[model samples]
Target: MSASNQGRIGVLLVNLGTPDSPQTPDVRRYLNEFLTDARVVDMPAAIRYPLFRGLVVPLRAPKSAKIYQQLWTERGSPLLYHGLDLQKRVQEQLGNDYLVAFGMRYQNPSVESALQELRDAAVSRIIVLPLFPQYAAASTGSVQEKVMDIVSKWWIVPSISFISNFVDEPGFIETFAMLGKAEMAKHDYDHIVFSYHGIPERHVLKGSHNGYCKLGNCCNSYNKNNRYCYRAQCFETSRQLGKALGLTPEQYTTTFQSRLQSRLRDPWLQPYTDEVIKEYPAKGIHNVLAFSPAFVADCLETTIEVGEEFKELFEEAGGKHWQLVPSLNSEPMWVEAVAGMIRRN
Candidate 1:
C-alpha cells in the first residue's frame, strides 16, 4: 500500500483509565465516574449513585489515595505512563502512515479527546483497540459504547473498527507466558494463582446464550458458545498460560478478586483471591506466584492489591513467600502483538 493509503488509517488505543493524580480529590473524581457507569455497577442511578457517591466513594477514596500514592512514579501513575509509552511504541512500529493515538475510558486523556484527534486527521477509517485482554461489559464494552455514542453524532463519520478482546491470541498468550516464565525461573513456588477482576455473577448469566456458561470446566475451553463470556475467557487465558509454563492442574488455582459490595443474594466470581490466599497455608502451599493477566499494565490492582496487599495476606496466613509476576506493560513483544493486530484488522 502507498504511504497515503496507509496514513488514512487511524488506530485508537483505550485502557480502563487512572486518576489524574494520587490526590484524594482526583481519585474521588475518577471513582465517581468509573463506579457510576451503569455497565460497571449494573444498578439504577437512583440507587447506584447514592450508594457509590454517598457510601463507597467517601469511605474508599482516602484509602485508595494512599494506595495510588504508593503506585505513583516520577512520570505519574504507572498505568498512565505505561499506556502513554505503549502508544508511542505502537506509533513507532506503524510509522507515520498510521495515526496511532490512545485514551483512557474514564479519566484524563479521555476517549472523546483521542477520537477528536483521529477525526481531525481526516482519516478514512479508525480502529479502536480496548487494552483489556478479556471482553467485559464494564471495560471493553463500555469503551465501544462511548465511542459509538460520540461518533454517531459526527456530521461525517469514519469507518470505525473495534478489537474487543484478544485473550486467546497467540501473541497475547505468549507475551504473558514469557513474563510468567521469567518469574518462575527465579524461584520454585508451591502454587500459582491466576487472579482476575471480579464481576457480578449476574453479569455472566445475563449474557449467556441459553445458559452456556455454567462457570465450571465449561470455561476451561472457549468456543462460540462462551466466546463473549468474561469468566470463560479468563479461565481460557489461565489454561493457555498453564500450557506454556508446563503447569499441571494441581499447581495452579484460578480465582477472582476486587469485588465491590453487592446484595447477599448476589455473588460475584468465586474462589475469591483474598479468601483463597488465607487457605493456601493449610493446603501446604506456602509460597505462591500470581499472574494478573486481566491487566496489560501494572495498575493499583496488580501493584498494590495483588503484589502488596495479597502478599501480606499470604504471609499472615503462615505462608512463606508470595510474588506477583509483572505485567506486560510496554514490553516489546506486546507492542508487536498490538501492532500486528492493527495490521491484521
Candidate 2:
C-alpha cells in the first residue's frame, strides 16, 4: 500500500460505563469517578471534588450498588457486553479493512486502553461513535472530550471524527420503531412515553445556539437555531419515533429521566419520567409502554431505573401493565444500526 493508504481506519464504540462489579466498593469507586468529572458535575474542582467525595458518593454509593447488583448479570454489565457484541459485529461487518473496539467512559475497558489498541493497530484515522442517540454535554460531549484529550497527547495524531447525535438517523429510528412495534403488538397500551436521560437546564442553556434555548417552548419544535440543543433533539427524537409508530401527538408524551440536582434548588430537565407516570393513573391511562432512546444499551438506567423503578411507581399510582420497551442492545437490528453508522463514518 502507498504511504497515503498506510493505515486502516479505527472505530471506537463508547458507552457511559458501569461498575466493575455490583459490590459497594466498586460501585462507590465508579460513582466517585463519574460524578467527579467536571463534564458531569459541572462544578469547580475545589467545590465539586469535596462535595462528591464527602457527601454525594458516601450517600448514594450503597444504594447505587444495590441497584447495580440488580442490574448485573452472569455476562456482566449489559452495557459492556452489548458494546463488546457490537464491536465484534461491526468488525465482522466491515471485514479486514477496518478495526473496531469498545470503551467505557468510566471503570473497566477504559477509553485510554481502547485508544492504545487503536494506536497499536496504526489506524490513520479514528471514528468515534458515543452510544448516545441524542447529543448532550454530559454524555456524548464528555465522551468526545475524553477522546480528544487522549489522542492529542500522541506524537502522531490521526484524523478523528465524532457522530455527535443521530436522533433522526434512519437506522436508529428504524430499530427503535421496530422495537416499539413489537411492544405495541403485545399489549393494548393506554399510552406511550418517550423518556430520555435528563441533563441540567443550565447545560441546555450553555449549549444553546445564540441564547436560543429558553427551556420553555423552544423544544416544541426542532430548528436550525436549536439544532444542537439537547432538549430539542430529544423532542425531535420522540417526534420521529412517533411518526414511525403511527402515534399522534395526543397518543404519547415526551419526558426526561434520571435527573441529579447539582446544587440547591437546581432543576434538571422537566416533565420528569417519575412525575409523568404518576399523572398517568389519574388520567385513566392504566397501561403504558415506555421508550428510553437516549440509552442504546440496557444498563442500570434502562433495565432497573426505567423498567423496574418506574414500573413500580406507575403501579403504586394505580396503573396496570407499565411496560418498558427494552433498549437497542446487541440484537441484529441494533447491530445493523450501529454497524451502519460506523461504516458510513
Task: Highest lDDT: give the candidate number.
Answer: 1
The lDDT for every candidate, in the order shown, is: 0.91, 0.88
Q: Which stretches of candidate 2 lie over 4 Å from their true place?
A: 1-5, 262-264
Can you give the lDDT of residue 191 in candidate 1?
92
- Tally clashes: model 2: 0
Give the TM-score of each candidate. 0.97, 0.97
**In candidate 1, what are the lDDT values of residues 1-345, reduced to their tens digit?**
776765568899999999999999999999999999999988898999998899989888999999889999899998898999999999999887789888999998999999999999988799999999999998999999999999999999988889999998888889988988898889989999999999988899898989887877788678999999999999989888889889998889999999863542478898899999999999899989999999999999999999999999999999998999999999999999999999999
Tens-digit lDDT track of model 2 for 122-159: 98889999988888888899999999999889999989
CA lDDT of 54 in candidate 1? 95
